[model samples]
Target: MPDRSSPETRAVLRAAVPPARRLLPVVLLGVASAGSSIALLAASAWLIARAAEQPPILYLSLGVVGVRAFALGRATFRYLERLTGHDAAFRQLASIRSGIYERMLPSAPDGLGMLRRGDLLARFTSDVDDLQFVTLRAVQPFVSAAIVLVAAVAGLAFLAPGSSLGVLACLVVGIGAAVLAERIAADRGARRLAPLRGDLQSAVVEHVTSLETLVAFDAAERSRTRIADLGERLARATRAQAASAGAAAAVMSALGGIAVLASIAGGLPQLASGRLDGPAFAVLCLVPLAIAEVAAAVPVAVAAWRTARVSAERIATAVPAEPPSGVVRPPAAAVAFPSGAGAPTLALRGVRAAWPETGTPSGPVLDGVDLDLAPGERVLLRGPSGTGKTTLAHVLVRFLDYGGSYRIDGVEAAELDPAEVRRRIGLVEQRPWLFDEDLRQNLLFARDTASDDELLAVLDRVGLGEWARERGGLYAPVGERGVLVSGGQAQRIALARAMLADFPVVVLDEPTANVDPDTAGRLLDDLLDAAGERTVLLIMHSVEVPAGVDRVVELTGRG
Candidate 1:
């Protein structure tokens, strides 16, 4: 059995059920359809038996009309059941996906980035679909089956009291078998099927996305073989579920058959004694079959519940809980850097930090780092790749935590509010993101009410002023991720955003990463000129720090 109190289990159950008011009509329609089906079959038997004795046409007319009405009612109600049920399911699934996405946003490119791309895709696509089945197939079917069962038994009780007891006996046994089957298979369903499906998804996605790399490296056959192995495991899990479903169906059938035969056996004596009529016996026999049809849904619901619960766990793991709301934000006010002695120094003493790997501290990515950026100082921090240069930049903006003392204007770094700290220190990291929006909207992220003159001035600093003027000035589309612009232009646009922020401390990580030496030199000069007296930590490689009014510090392995 699933741990009913587990958070994933609770979430899965809650998402699958929706509100009772919304699902009531769906369940009631299902019950109506099942009742009509039972009535139609029973009426057919009554008309056949009564007509065999040559009853008058007038007497048989009611039975014939009942068969017609029940038949049409069955079809209409079944259609309504499907239509109503699917509408609710769609609405519920949309809400579920939206909630997951909203929770995922705050943790983006951090907690969410830990999952492989394939696993993430599977959760949003296949796993979400599996959860949808819980509402549409699992929960709906069970509720419908229950209501119909109660109505069917009540009808039999009015027809033949003695046979009603037999019918009830049959139902209990049939439903009991289904419940037992579910209990036996629940754990296996969760333990085996979910992981296999996720692995298969990851394998196929990895192979497809990396096909070019595999072929170039001559590992195409190897990737194909690995995919086949994952496929085999998935197949096994599917077969196991199918087997369990088949067994549950078989058990329900066996108990149902026994119940029907028992009802008939018990009815023969009533018939012999003239206590039950021919039509009543036929109705009694048919009632068990109708109830069995509803009872059979139990095992399928079990499987769907298992699938959805596993999906819930995966989704919960992928998106961390949102941080508490109503944060005490400091009042927005201009920060005046202390300008007298030492010029608002940002000092670090024996700073050590590491990027976390799997919830544990990784090998020191930043070690024994000591640095200071006094106000109006433009420091060029030169380093080789993977030497924690960008990591250190992350540290400066409070994006990461560091050991030892870090002070800005004589205040502990950790003691300050993170949001205000970030506002005071701006960043133009390597490969900055640009949405598919016009240039004005992009600049608004840095300053919401920046005037036209201010925007144009910064754009001109990045040498994109003429480009902007030619393309509708501040309203040109930059396409997705600025794809319409050249690589150098994208970098320049990012630099413009940082310049517009006008923070006291600014960090530029590889601002010239995509430019030629001549272009890079020119861009650096433009940036430094625009920067003016702001304290800047510029991380660059290969190119010399061009005539900057600042000193260059080259990192050597440590920190």
Candidate 2:
């Protein structure tokens, strides 16, 4: 569990608060809305009691008008309050999510392995959303209610001091009781709700994504049982929180009745002594009911605070305050990438690196790796499994930081911005991710300005053009994770995407890892041929190295 006072948690909570300018209208409107409700009730009470005396019609005109005005004001202000409040909250939610995403970028892919896909989804989508309540349900309502409560009590004080004191005392006691009930009944449940919800969501995602494997292994029923068990836990927690909220509302309702009784009892003596008129006494008795309604927001606000705090803590835990070890952090003033080249020369000497999750360099995956790629050269990098071929690929793209010297065009790669380095050198992972969209949409993301003819041409270059035409041009669906395509075809599409990107140097990491043995040789040849003079670092393991132009280097996994 993350401490609520941790800097990361505090930062996340702060992001939930919209700018004062944006939130001010919400607060002001809420104050007006709650104030109108109180005034409307008071005005109605006065009008009804004063009418019983058979006063002239003209004498009742002011009271009737006051009632109408307050009623209209209440509805109008309430509508504006909701609109502004929700607007501010939604804007703040966007800011909070953007901040979290910006922080995650430095540790994405490798460093974020600790976050499972379902858990990450819950944190990013669900937990971040809960922070919005900090404004909507908690701060806005609490501030507005407090102001209205104070003003209502003060107005009563001027009318009948005794009744005012009684109402004030009842309010204090009632609010205290409500808050106490909420804390006792719901605090634990509110705190547990976020994590439990996240757990359940994660289990559902895992079960759905792995349903095929579960059924194949005869464990689908078991998985379903686990999901059911998680859902039950979440439901129980939700019920406990709901019950607590109901208890608080019940306390406030009981307080309202007690307040009305206290007002009547205190006002009766004044009524008989002629100090208080019938209209004033009626106002005293009826106002507390409206005030009690406004006061109901207090316990609910407390609950919202608890829930938001837990969500903030979870967000802080999900995205680290700082990037972990071995994760690349952009320099404060990064040097620009060396410009002017068909393909820049790449050189590395004594380079060492580790995955970000390792948290230290003591167990480096790639140690003392020395390799060089001349301009427009095609090099084959061969190694057995676990020889750090993929690690080297990641380093070349600046996904993971490296030690020692790595230079591009004789300029130190570390000094250049990682984004700039990535623009120059692209990586096609062994398993490329294809969005579940038509083929054109997938290729367009690489270079959005590419024409349809250009896309077809690149597809042809990577041996996917004829296949794409058969499927239906660029409109064919790739399915989620490219499940609709074969392993070899997926690789070809990935290469097509790279070709469209037009990186100066491309790192192909185990491109044939997923294809059958007989097809691997042909796929490798087509991929290299598609390179057409761009520097290529082809990483291969278990597959035989095809005849290449420049050179072949093998990593022995020895420092």
TM-score for every candidate vs. truth?
Answer: 0.76, 0.95
Q: Give the clash count for each candidate.
A: 0, 0
What is residue 352's positional error in candidate 2, in angstroms?
A: 2.1
Query: Relative to the unseen true structure, what is the Cα RMSD of model 2?
Result: 2.2
Evaluated against the true structure, the overall lDDT of model 1 is 0.76
Model 1 per-residue lDDT tens digits across residues 459-504: 9977889999999999999997777887678878887888787777
Give Cα distance to truth, residue 247, candidate 1, Å: 4.0
In Å, residue 194's CA in model 2 sits off its true spot by 0.8
* Candidate 2 segments whose C-alpha is farther than 4 A from its true place: 1-4, 359-362, 547-549
| Reference-based lDDT, each prediction | 0.76, 0.89
Model 1 vs. true fold: TM: 0.76
| True lDDT of residue 383, candidate 1 | 83
